[model samples]
Target: MAVSLLCCDWLKEYKTRHRVGIQIRGTVESISKRFFTEVPCVGQVLGDSFAEIKSLGMPEHFCEDELLFILNTDKRKSLTLKYYARKILYFLRQQNILRSLKTFLEQPEEQQSALEGAVLVDQYCNPLADVTLEGISVQLDEMVEKVKKTLRLKNPSHPSLRCAQGFFSSKAMSIPISLSVLYMTLSHKLGLHLEPVNFPNHFLLRWCQRPRGEGNEKSYQLLRDSLDLYLTINPDNVQYLLLQARLYFHLGIWPEKVLDILQHIQALDPSQHGAVGYLVQHTLEHIQHKKHPVTPDEKRRSAPEHVEVQYSVGLIMKHKRSGYNCVIYGWDPKCTMSQEWITTMRVQQLSKGANQPFYNVLVQDGTCRYAAQENLEPHSAPLEIGHPEVGRYFSEFVETHYVANEELEMRYPEDTRETLGKVHELYHGLSLDSGHQDQASNQPNHTTNM
Candidate 1:
């Protein structure tokens, strides 16, 4: 039977080319200057004007400084600017500016300063989402308890205090943002100050403390030389500075205050690396694509191969007296064939009258073997079942019967035992083969021999 159903639909490209009804030509330099001048600062426009500009597709390369200036025009208290900055940052990530912003954000704070005022607050902030510092902090606390419980369960052998140590060392279970927030919350509750270090696809926390000394003179010296140096140098690192800014923002630090710190760092050093670039690029892209944005093209990627069936064969047994027929299907994707063979045997019995099931069982094995031989060079080693006793019996049976290694043994010790067990379990009235069981029972333990 032919199943004529839709497998997958190929995407059709739709092009909507529009001709410019009116054209104006200008020099590249002049166009660049005009572009900067025409792009309004984030808070300069009212709701209606902002909506119109957004509808027209936000132009690339706007003056971020001017936008900040406008945001701060009314004592740096423009709710409009705050709203847009969040929105822009979100938009930038959607537009694949994540990588760029991550890189820009990672640059030294001084270097980032060049971009501070230039990058509009609206470009990074959005007013639509009702996210609050308190709400996020509460969420962080909840997440921490969850992580701690999960870790305790996952590593019962480890001490409760040490359970979280694995989270730091093991790459397998890297701390996610959700977990980071929890850690941040826990730190606050425990009276330990810690900030999230936003690394790519992972997070780390940092804690700073002042050094102690006995007397005032010694304490002052230690504080100035050791404690002060450590405090001053630690946050100076680009990664640390960006993380501090993020932590401050989450802690309800004023947007302008955050910007001020960001600008100082940017001014000190401008080299772009890691998270900072991701933050910046994400902000810019968001501002430009607030509306009338183009849908990103989807790329078709190949799926990963999971299990491979190595080799397979079929066996048939005919009962002349009862007029019943039984077929045994066997396969080994890897050299270890026992599990697949057992499964196939059960399936064949269950599917005795079903054509599709029988054929599918046979065809799948054949396909797997063919693909393995053709695609894989010089064929990898067949899966070895690794059970020493089973291996010994198999070897002896092949030697005695002069059978090929691939052939299933008719009277192997393990097979005989399994077959006898199944017969006893399934057939209460019938007397089964005793000689095969006796032969298997007489075999010496291979573990002792080893």
Candidate 2:
């Protein structure tokens, strides 16, 4: 969710006018032209394409591409649309945004997925060109199995169980709409076309069939078939809205479009029953607030870090970005990951005078690798450190921390202090002036580290 310009104040006036039934005529054509009249480039771009598809979400298997366009501090910076668009006041928004705007406009028109069609089909799923609904579904089912294996494989006896329902760890820990959203995303990415239809209970996919007499592939096509999958979602309004937001975020849906859908939802279900109306309103307000160029100074303040952490080798932790549990094996005071990863990370902006710590952990789904301190979080449940070579380093899991036995020191005494220091610094951000504590001592609380 990028910084937006349409806030509650703007919505307050707009909603008031709507409530009073004051219909404003004319398309956004006129509005965009008038609004961006001074900014000719922007006006023209808007007239051509209101918004571009920046990026989209991927299935768990494609987790690495989640934030596909990494926000580089040097390359990618953020400011409210106002500061840049309107050129307001001293905090002159960076020129990078203008560069991005130029780059965005310069991109091939085919990349503007929103303008292409609401009925989005993959490159391979062209009904007229050559694919059939049944054939697509068969292919989709196979991809679904791959998705299933990447996540929960077999169905649980109790259907409503969190794991059975596509939730990992627990209901509270994971996103509410994980299953259907991921399932639908994977199916779509695997060449199945989908769009929600008028019917409340049915989720449908629109497919066009070529006319029998048509000789040309580019001729006007007919809306001949729709692939309907029997999909049912529990009537939970808050979660439902959350899912909608996540899906829209994943699909690169524009805020204005989302606003229209929210308004439509309000009109469709006016009863304001079962939290749906409230959720809709809250989300609408959030969307509007995000669009606002002006933000209160209070919202700009960064909160202090509240977490007190003590980590150890053999201590199981979780990868923050990927949500995968990993076992700590080694640590690096300096950023010493792969050249690609290290370089990719260097563009990131961090707090002044901050140390970029690196942790060497083994991700369960894949291989052992290193991630920055900013990317690893402590895991609660004990993940039996399953790396076969665990015996090569750690002696025992004394607690949350592991200890290196006498055998390690006898073999490589030179490397012992470095290993211990890496663990110590990562766990406790302390000055060397404060005497280094004994590695074997389980006195995390007694020591001032906490």
Candidate 3:
């Protein structure tokens, strides 16, 4: 998962509030919004549309048409919504109720799966439309039998079971109540009275009543008797524990807990957990605060040429022999791999041999390589390296190179700045030489028209 860096203080406050029993409302959509608001780097790197889709967990609110609108909005760099319809849309989508209802109207009565009536109720009394509370109530009452029959079904495997159960749980009408609170809060933020309404997933419209207005307001009527199933997660459930570990990693929180869960998963199923093993290794590396385990000591060098690092992290370099483009993420003053690797690659044949700096680079071919500094040159025509682990190290692509994110910066703080500085200096030197040549070409004809 691409990282979403949050404000440390905000995360601390959330943890505190969670401990104190102060509930955090809103659905995953709101959570995703908060995530993007914090980690602007994600949008910068992956493009805004990709980041937006990832945040939703499932693009329930954003169908194919809605996705196109967002994609176009990204390209045009415009489009604003005044209402909290997005939040409601996100929640409905996650509940798997949005599309099911929209498609239901197009299908026969026997084909209607679930939440068809709620979709109708929303269409009729949308907060953006001039519909009455009584009208919404009558619609809800009429759909009660259908909703009850659907909810009462004994199939535990149905995905629709997740929908509106929050309403039928200990707190009835929770969906509407929570949404009302969300509407008020968002309206306050926008300095306007607005609520959520989706025009069958195409348009988002809002309608708000004034304080002294005598007109009937739109409302949601929560249905009853929907069953909610809760599962017990203990230490033995390897799959669930693996998921928990991944969730911790995804949220960018609790490194210790992530490591522990991953370790636990590895322990529970030693033979079949190769992926878990990789995660455990990565977690351990992260915890150790060392990019390379055997970093050579430059200060206590035994020889003059020992541990002399030339290129810094984030530099785009091309291998001289094999001619592959790669980006440096780490380096050791000397080759740090085992003697077996050194022999296999024949490190002794090179000019500097095993004593020269060896960079840890992400190759364009989606593999990592540790190449001797003698083999690398600043790429003549630098382009983006197509590596899977690029996001793990870099945040954004600048004109000529990738910018290191907070994690990479922490690992090698000075490298990012120094690397860019050197590149800029080289560029300026070339530009000055070119300018002088241009000036010479434009000079007055001193040779008397020869």
Candidate 4:
């Protein structure tokens, strides 16, 4: 996954409070208010109409014409009241607006009274008597650009870009939730109709209107029927779904909702068991931790480790080719082609003074096997190296030629001493190397077999 293992801490905390039916009406109301009053002037325009829609309980008695009038009044010309009216009409049909209002009113009296305190005004009062589609489109385009510019400034290191980098560099999968949020915000500002798909463990956004249709004349009707068509087709574009999931997850969507999104993702890509498994495990871990106290060790053990290894190994390999690093492999009896093997690589560099040697070491496991490239000509490992056992044997040969006088105790530290010892224990007992050494030397210097 492109997601960082570093997010475990945050996810854990999120899981704890992400209980079902955790009402966030107050928070939503607060955001709605700020979005109207403190955000760009466009928000103020949309907020005003929305505020009226809320106050009147989105009356079933109110028709489209009246809503259009409220939106395009003399005070709200710049507001694109028709767009807001269309959105409100869509929400009413979807039952999202009325449902929200009902939920709000059903809350405790203090909560209900709190929402009522916010005043609704003609914040978008447009002096113009009539609005045209062309005008609305032009205004929406400008607003969309403004929102994009604002968000770029607000979150310079956006999560989507980060996720993309993660994918290219480490093969990690990250849900680009923030990017989806940006898309939604921009789409809303631009008056571009869209809908969020709640996929299992992910989210996706779809343009309500198709990019093309049977003909230009049919386009308007197609646009009007877009939502219904989308609901019927139920697109499952993986990339779009993942983006949506990330957005919802970042917005602190309920786990059930997140899972619903992810299930759809799983259905599309069954091999994505790793990602799905992590979601389920981590979410359960969150629930468990909340229900009871967990020790530091328990928490640590529950953390997802796959991406960490991938990231670390990727970093090590990036610098390995400069002859500035070396890898040491320790033998494990249980090791097999399917089992991951650990290798420690050290990056060599000079410290402040020439006399000070510095080494930054990373120990990790890689699924890529050295033997996988055996079919290639002049097949050789990039470093002309193998396990530490091979290095130790080569060291013995070096000792015979150049360091006979130097005692092993004087030259090797404890850790190195142990490594060399293991090498001797494994290979010294076998006479195969002793007998085949010359024969192997006589053969052409082809690739060393793993």
lDDT (tens digit, per residue) of candidate 1 on 290-389 = 4334432221111122123222222122223322222222322223335576465343343231112111111111111111111222111112221111
lDDT of 2 at 323: 80
lDDT of 1 at 396: 22
List the candidate 2 regions with Cα displacement exceeding 4 Å. Answer: 1-310, 337-339, 345-355, 398-401, 405-450
Between candidates 1 and 4, the one scoring higher on TM-score is: 4
lDDT per residue for candidate 3 within 1-450, as digits (tens), equals 224454256667555544322111223123333222222121111212233444544323234334333323432111111011233333333234334334555577655533435444454333223444467667766686576667668665555555653234323334554766676788779888765543322223355543311111111111000100000212367655666565444534335757767677777788637877777677676546422334322222234654477788778899999888999977877889999999999999999889888988888766677899999999876778866456556666665777765555655666776787777866656788999999999988678554
CA lDDT of each prediction against the hidden true structure: 0.33, 0.39, 0.53, 0.35
The per-prediction tally of clashing pairs is 56, 9, 1, 31
Per-residue lDDT tens digits of candidate 2, residues 82-183?
A: 112221111011122233333444567656433122222321123113333456657756885676665564654434433453333332444424554666
Query: In model 3, which range of ten residues has the least summed lDDT?
Result: 222-231
- Models, CA RMSD each: 28.1, 25.2, 20.5, 27.3
Please provide the root mean square deviation of candidate 4 (C-alpha atoms, Å).
27.3
Runs of candidate 3 exceeding 4 Å displacement: 1-307, 447-450
The C-alpha stretches of model 1 lying farther than 4 A from their native spots are 1-63, 76-96, 99-450
TM-score of 3: 0.39
- Pairs that clash in candidate 2: 4-290, 4-291, 4-292, 5-291, 5-292, 5-293, 6-288, 6-291, 6-292
lDDT score of residue 7 within candidate 4: 52
- After superposition on all CA atoms, how large is the RMSD of candidate 3? 20.5
